[model samples]
Target: MVGWLIDAIKKDYQPPISKVKVGKFNDYVQREYDFDKLEKKLLGWE
Candidate 1:
């Protein structure tokens, strides 16, 4: 049963992001937010 499930997962797995797309996403996020401040606020540092 577990082996079957593992095989199914391995068959379905894919890289969620390609390298070129990864950089665009990072640039979009940084342009859209003050990420460091957002992180600190979410972490309760501020």
Candidate 2:
């Protein structure tokens, strides 16, 4: 397993965003995830 930031620095690479995205695919943009609605649906609540 390789570290993104470490590898980037080693290769002198720069990313579009300055945020450190770790342990997952870096495809997800920052967004508001409605966990409350998801939980309601999971519990079958209206």
Which predicted model would earn the best TM-score?
2
Best by lDDT: 2
Per-residue lDDT of 1-46 in model 2, one digit per residue for the tens?
Answer: 4698788889999657778657677667888879999899999995
Cα displacement (Å) at residue 44, model 2: 0.1
Write candidate 1's Cα lDDT for 7-28 as tens digits: 8798995657755634554564
Off by over 4 Å in 1: 1-31
Candidate 2 weakest ten by summed lDDT: 18-27
lDDT agreement with native, every candidate: 0.79, 0.82
Pairs of residues at least 3 apart in sequence or in different chains that clash in candidate 1: none
Measured over all alpha carbons after superposition, the RMSD of each candidate to the real structure, in angstroms, is: 10.9, 12.6
TM-score of each: 0.32, 0.34
